[model samples]
Target: MAKANVKTVEKAVEKVVNLPAGEKIERDGGEVTALDAASIRLVMQGWEIRKKIDELDAQLKSINAQLIEAHGAGASLVVHGVCRASIAEREAVKITNAERLKAVLGFRFTDLVKTEIAYKPEAKLIEMAADGDEPMAPSIRECLTVGKSASVTWRAEK
Candidate 1:
């Protein structure tokens, strides 16, 4: 990015981060931050923030359960006009036994159910194909797409 754009971003961050509590700020959609730094301070700061957020989220789940137990579903609580908590109820169906449901539904199964397809590589066929000594089905080989993915993990050092 241009020097002017980078400066503008720094000024915006300063303004947002320095905002007073109880004030709301709307943010627009954007990509990752423009600059990257090798500083250990920034790396540790980000990891610590992530850990704190995760801890708070877990705590909130337990608190939410307690609220539901005390007030029951459809009960809403307004907290000092700042926030509200409610358990929204909805009906959703899940098939517990696929074979049993299919048999029970009979001809109606095809009309009611939607099918999902997935593929996994066959290790024996792949090995044989690699050696070029045994014949492998062209249909099976054509269905396979080989690829790899990578990810990064960060945690507090003990």
Candidate 2:
């Protein structure tokens, strides 16, 4: 019986060895061969996985494009204020025009959609002398002191 089993195995090996590497071996019984069936399924599964990955890649690219567009339209401002507290200090240049300030704040200057300014004195005081004229407010000096930082937000005009 051992010899017979060895002969049967030898015949099976001989039958497979002559055919191409990937070609299926003929069988009489209703049974599936592992290698042939697995290769076909692998090919099909790989195509499906590639298709899904392509769809996801397209979606990611669209989202990134939108983010780039939004970032271009809006940006953050960093205002650095330098303070010089000296007995004799040069006058501070007040930024009165909204359009000019807006240009200074951003790389690309454009007309302002709206302008607003909040100050402690609540008035735009140029200068004064002796007499009953109101003395210059300390806050005005503070505002003029360069290096003293403050940030004002404004919408960019379309």
- Which candidate leads the pack in TM-score? 1
C-alpha TM-score for every candidate = 0.46, 0.25
Model 1 over residues 1-158: C-alpha lDDT tens digits? Answer: 69999999998777656643332234665433433333334655788899999999898777876776677666566665366665544432333444554554467455545545522223443443355554433433343344432212222332
Q: Please, what are the lDDT tens digits per residue for candidate 2 over residues 1-158?
A: 99999999998777656544343445776554545544655666788999999999898666545544544323443233532111211333443443433444353222212234531111233231112354433433433323222222333332
Off by over 4 Å in 1: 1-38, 117-158
lDDT of 1 at 149: 26
By TM-score, how accurate is candidate 2? 0.25
Instruction: Give me the displacement of residue 53 in model 1, in angstroms.
Output: 0.6
- As for candidate 1, its clashing pairs are none
Candidate 1, 69: how far from true, in Å? 0.7
